[model samples]
Target: MSNFLPTLQQNSSNNFQGDENNLQKTIKPQRGFKWNSKQPQKQQHPAISSLNTPTHNNSSNSSNKDIIDFNYTPSHQLPYLNNRNFNNNSNVPKLAQVSSHKDLKKLVETTLNSDSVLEQAIKLPKGENINEWFAVHTVDFYNHINMLYGCVTEFCSYDTCPKMIATNEYEYLWNINGVPKSVSAPDYVKYLMQWCQKIFDNEKIFPTDSNVPFPSNFEKNYIKPMLKRLFRVYAHIYCHHFNEIYEMNLQVLLNTSFRHFCCFTKYFKLLSNDDYGPLLELVNELS
Candidate 1:
């Protein structure tokens, strides 16, 4: 393995800049009216914050969706990337990798309770360096979404879901290199995570050595774009698999995780109004 001791500044900078430009362009303009919600936060699950998610009582969230017994395999995952062996998450940064060992199997087990999730999201720890703080939480949020989505992989198949959609209105298409591709939801999500994984694994982008400062454009160029895409994963899961999430009694944990994600993104202003379009209402209603 090559140590990312010194960044080839010109090359690395140009590469990410090119990627940023490509990411700025969407496959098609997302159709929606943008408005800040002044709606009162509705009551949430006892263990989570008030969110604009469908309650279990909602008729659309049937407890008995046709669930298949298939394990999802990402057909397009990078060859170097293999199945997670939970015991060794060397690929993940040190801070993000901590404390997760206590419960990897219990997907519903959340690290934060309702009262603390939002409060914790916005407060940078007193001793923490901001970029380093972002580095850790970025990895944390990624893992949270990753585990949450893993729960519904079998249900969100290419045949079952042709497009990566949220709210039945916003359909997300993947950008391959510089070209946009209208791929299946599973494929689109897989491609998106791969993009994030690549960034995290690259020390220049997310430094494994704390001594090596984060790249100059790390937050603006990498973190925001990465988190923006991660939000889509949440949107897709909430829109398409909330029923399954509800059935498994994971809705509270899912809601809490998503709330934490939203609060963090909102605090940092990492995303624009356009970026949150799919989940805008919920975001606006976040208490």
Candidate 2:
């Protein structure tokens, strides 16, 4: 045990208490050592100086080591860019398109007005070919049919419009080009409503104080036809106009002034009366 203790002491002295003569050897105190006051941070060392440079080797050791340089850009521009134009006289694309349409219309009109084109277009075909009168008559017939259909349809479309009379049933008037003629009740109602809307939407029945009164002649010519048409067709009549049922019923067939038709009862008292003799007489007189 004594031999082992001397050997252990010799090893401790060599490690913890180095020879004072060797400059490279260090002697560290046992557990109760004080802090070293002579040591300084190596700020002037070449390794540290390299680390402070902005070179690649210095950046390699930093937290942002992998960050690469790039020129970033945004996706969209602000609305003001729409107003930016280099040429002052350059019109917008939409305006140019509209101008092109106007130019085309003028060119077509000019061409049609030329002597050869006008003469050729006006010339009639030979041997039962297309005649001027035939074209006119065909157009007139279709126009009349369309107008009549529109009038009736628009009037009958109103929720309050009266049911059609027995004569107004969807029956064949005539076969056209082998096609069966048919006009549904709903079709008639739709046309009637459209016609009525056109006429009454902006029409003033009676003038007001602020406005100049419409001329009496205008009323007699224009307004009278409209009023007659409306009275003849619109189904419901209230107190004021029920007395004129004869005039209204007869006017339905004679007048073409109404754009659309609708009717209303004029007076409850007259409507309830069992004696419709006066009304019948008025209708007969008109007819």
Top lDDT hit: 1
Tens digits of lDDT, candidate 2, 161-232: 333221222121112234323333343333333332332222232222113333444333333333322232
Quote the RMSD, in angstroms, for model 2.
51.7
Please list the Cα RMSD from the true structure of every candidate, rounded to 1 decimal place. Answer: 15.2, 51.7
How high is the CA lDDT of each candidate model?
0.55, 0.24
lDDT of 2 at 261: 15
Alpha carbon lDDT at 127, candidate 1 = 62
Q: Which one is best on TM-score?
A: 1
Q: Candidate 2: TM-score? A: 0.19
The C-alpha local distance difference test score for the whole of candidate 1 amounts to: 0.55
- lDDT value for model 2: 0.24
lDDT of 1 by residue, 1-287 (tens): 11112211110111242243223211110111011112112122222222224433454543344332221111111111132233345642322222242343232233444456447545676665678667656766766677777777767787888877765556666665665556777777667665666566555666544456778878888888778777888878877777666665466667667777777788878887677765677776663
